[model samples]
Target: MGASQSDNAHLSKADVVSRIKTRLASADIKKAQEVGGIFLFNIIKGTTVYSWTLDLNKVEVFEGEPEDDPDTTFTLNEHYFKQLVYGKEDARTIMQAGRCSVTGDIMRAMKLEPYIKLN
Candidate 1:
């Protein structure tokens, strides 16, 4: 359940990664450690949910539930997350509906609010 590049009107996980990587390319995760979150990147691992971290230069990829209480956690299907990359839904609203949950450091998560381009 993903969009093709030819479509040019949709987005895929790759696209989401591209966007996030782009935004985080220069972001110093270590310096931004004050902004602590589980940073879950849910990817399809052979029909299972695979979560990982995208903090700074360290990518602590792993399986199972997150350890720390994330500032915000995005609970979305791969397809929906991709749609977010394509600007199909409003991140703020999604968060409001409990699709995305922020447990701690809400403001820090909010700081990442504007960076998400949900079109």
Candidate 2:
């Protein structure tokens, strides 16, 4: 983990989002199905905020929020999101420290680590 510090240190929100989209799209649904739930991400960048949704139930990840309420919603800035995806920070720790805002089914939020984490 230490050897790749520089690689992950410069990681951007776009890079992480592209990776997640690609990974989730190619992911084996049968296994991903085990973590079923809709997770929404609000990624802030300056004055712009982009929203993404990971519908584990459908085994898909897409831009824009879901039609209905998500099982969990995570709101954080682009920098923090990149950090989260690269495992530079823990989701719970960020939320606890007010770096991230989570709404609904907070405990289930931890299950999202695998889905977002970059290898």
Candidate 3:
């Protein structure tokens, strides 16, 4: 079984940022390093939102924008990303639905999604 709806629903912006940081601290970021350049996400958590970044190799958390523009920026809600990570939804479809948006290098960003598993 997956995490409860409440688990998804009760998430706060900081909680969402923390989750991404914790997830990056795991093996996901190692996988992400193959594709260079940084990623920035504006995570929508209910009524609030926050930005976060993953230093793929460093596996460190950077709370604010980087000095350079990110290779891509993913804007979406926590629930939608949870679905992507859990394999409940395809990344392409999500992007098509307008639930996902990207900027900068499109091909590289598209390639990066496969490595972003939730667990």
Candidate 4:
């Protein structure tokens, strides 16, 4: 579903993480298995903080503190995070607008796009 859809506006951080995990599981494993790295997502909603880690090597997801240093980290508010996951907003646009912050190896972040969405 698109991020702009009304229902998406009500999604919590956990909901978004679950959806992303589902999408990743159904993604093309061959494309991701050889691309091993860790991606960290730090999402903020009001006073709550949520963190998720994506491990490409094993196609695993951990919904808490990362076990190791992440190859790339993205920090953003919950709304923009959902927008990014659902394709309602592109990463570059949000990053350029200062709505999202990215750190670490950017190339690794680019490699994550295909695994992040079903569409």
Candidate 5:
């Protein structure tokens, strides 16, 4: 099932980061290691910015810019980021609408869908 409205409403950037970290650490994400690389998520909420990184075995979430270069970077507003994660929004639709922007390796970004259940 998709995330509830109330559930989504209560989520903060840090909550989302924590979810990603927990999700990636699960045994379910073992297959994700195959397509892993340094991925950076740049989420903007009003004037605030939140960033997180995923590199195969580890997931690091922090405020501000990533310390190292990312193999793939995803830029989007916090709302869309939550929507995507909660299965309330379609990644392709958002990307097509220009609401989501990606840089670096397109294929690597595509590979992340399975891990995030965006597929």
Candidate 6:
């Protein structure tokens, strides 16, 4: 059976960040350690671009820039970002297909998939 409208709901960037904060309130940071690495996600919607940093060491997601440089930075449009968070798309494949761009260490960036699944 198909999922109801609510089950297939897509989260905005703000929604995804809020969801991460909610999860951290309950789970320990160590859960993040399992996923490893830090990433700064730059989601672009048209000319509007916003950034969020995913720091597994602290298990935190916050808007704007990171305290220090991130291990990897991922730049994708809002559409591809939704796919990433939903685990319906792979970041590596997205990069390969030119749907997204990654900077810094890609192997470390690849470590982020499990964290996205945590969403």
**For this target, which candidate reaches the highest TM-score against the unseen true structure?**
4
Q: Rank by TM-score, highest first.
A: 4, 2, 5, 6, 3, 1
Of 4 and 5, which scores higher on TM-score?
A: 4
In TM-score terms, candidate 5 sits at 0.81
Question: Deviation in angstroms for 48 in model 1?
Answer: 2.4
- Any idea what lDDT model 3 has? 0.68
Instruction: Name the lDDT of candidate 4.
Output: 0.82
Query: Model 1 over residues 9-61: C-alpha lDDT tens digits?
Result: 44445555666666665565565555545555565524767454444225232
TM-score of 3: 0.69
How many residue pairs clash in each candidate at the backbone level?
1, 0, 0, 0, 0, 0
Better-scoring candidate (lDDT), 1 or 6: 6
User: What would you estimate as the lDDT of candidate 5?
Assistant: 0.72
Better of 4 and 6 by TM-score: 4
Candidate 1 clashing pairs, residues 3+ apart or interchain:
87-119
Q: Assess the local accuracy of residue 56 in candidate 2 as a C-alpha lDDT between 0 and 100.
A: 89
Give the per-residue lDDT of model 5 (tens digit) for 1-119: 34556665687878766766666666354566667677788888889778877675444435455566888888999888887877778788888899989989877777676456422
Model 3, residue pairs in steric clash: none
Candidates arranged by lDDT, highest first: 2, 4, 6, 5, 3, 1
* Per-prediction TM-score to the true structure, in the order listed: 0.53, 0.85, 0.69, 0.89, 0.81, 0.80
Give the CA lDDT, 0 to 100, for residue 88 in model 5.
Answer: 78
lDDT of 2 by residue, 1-119 (tens): 67686777666666667789888877778767887889999999899999989998898888889998899998999888887887878877788899999988887778777678886
After aligning candidate 4 to the native by TM-score, how far in Å is the CA of 44 from where it should be? 0.8
lDDT of 6 by residue, 1-119 (tens): 24532453555688876766666556556756776667888999989999998888777778988988888898999888877776667777789999998888787777665456533
Least well predicted 10-residue stretch by lDDT in candidate 1: 55-64
Q: What is the C-alpha lDDT of each candidate?
A: 0.52, 0.83, 0.68, 0.82, 0.72, 0.75
> Over the stretch 44-89, how does candidate 4's per-residue lDDT look in tens digits?
8888889999889789787986778888899999888878887788
Model 5 residue 41 distance off true place after TM-score fit, in angstroms:
0.6
